[model samples]
Target: MNYDDRRASPRYPLRAFAELGSSDREWAAHVLDISYYGARIALLDEYNLCAGDPIRLRLEIPEMQVPEGMLPYLHLEGTLVHQQEHMLGIQYEPASELDAELLKQILANLNK
Candidate 1:
């Protein structure tokens, strides 16, 4: 994808495992494909997601998911953007200032 496009993007490939959550519902046991403002997460069996569904995310970074498996955890509030097969795509809500800044940097780097 072209980072210079008006669309938001990520700097580097962020590979991590994610657990999806929502008010009154939680789905765990899956890895997520993450970027700056969104993600495509693989769901475990028995989970059904749809467009317009709001969600929460927990991303476990590689180092955290392997070896000692710690740190780089992320808590995100987002909404479903799309879904295909077993993958659920989401767009993050603008919540924390820190997260917004970080996402901005990630996209900026992608332009380089």
Candidate 2:
């Protein structure tokens, strides 16, 4: 099987504000879908950014599992790898142990 067939990912919609800089310049975007590894985003506005631009995207997720949670999504440093129209595909810059574990579980679930 190919890699895509071997790995399973979740597809969910998230409302978020994407910032280009540390300063609070934000843009509204929709989470097209997400795997534990990375995500595909559809931006509402047009942005002229190149590949390898380090960007931090705040993914807005609903808080229902815990009473007190800081943020729904983990902080990620993304490298722009692919782009098509308004959609962008990025790979996590440095995926941690937790991210790797979660991705493994997600892929296992998807294959099963």
Candidate 3:
């Protein structure tokens, strides 16, 4: 079966820089795409992350403008669900209402 067919939600193509953090370390990652429940990312460096490992992600959206000293980012917590070479798939945990709303807005903008 195709990967999209197995997903719980539709994925939107998104290209952005991000930071992926695990309990012991962090890596610079590139956001390939995202869905309400998960995201696909490519790490800039090598690391040994496996399926079911917990992780934190902070996506930096360049299109969104913020005040001085502030950064426009979306922070999410998830588990590693898939990995191949430098790329990995993440299944996000349930987010707060604010985060959910923000994600929805981002997805909507992507469609335009």
Candidate 4:
């Protein structure tokens, strides 16, 4: 089967625990793939995460492997842009300068 790749930035496959929610709700999820712009996460539990809804993402990162001085988690605010069954697609908002650099470093390490 043939598939078209429409992503502006390449995505790296990563299996990591993550948290997705709003101020009032949160759910356990596993990150399947990630890029600087967004990520695709599989829910560990049932929830109603819909497109256009604001959400916060907290993804666990290995402290030892990350660039020095970076935190052990990726925390960002985003919007749910798509969903399929148990997976939710998140589009991250403009993040802090540090967060952006950390994401770049993380992606580089993942691809190594």
lDDT of 3: 0.84
lDDT of 1 by residue, 1-44 (tens): 53235347642445556778877777774644456777667776
| Candidate 4 Cα misplacement greater than 4 A, ranges | 1-4
TM-score-best of 1 and 2: 1
> What tens digits encode model 4's per-residue C-alpha lDDT throughout 35-80?
8888899986878667899998988886665777778887878899
Backbone clashes, each candidate: 2, 0, 0, 0
lDDT leader: 3
The residue pairs in collision within model 1 are 64-69, 64-70
12-78, model 3: which lDDT tens digit per residue?
8988999999999999999999988999999969897899999999888766633335437778899
Off by over 4 Å in 1: 1-6, 64-71, 98-112
Cand. 1 TM to true fold: 0.66
The residue pairs in collision within model 3 are: none
My TM-score estimates for the predictions, one after another, are: 0.66, 0.58, 0.87, 0.87
Error of 4 at 64 (Å): 4.2
**Whole-model lDDT per candidate:** 0.63, 0.55, 0.84, 0.81
Worst 10 residues of 1 by lDDT: 62-71
Error of 1 at 22 (Å): 1.4
Q: Which residue runs of candidate 3 sit more than 4 Å off their true CA positions?
A: 65-71
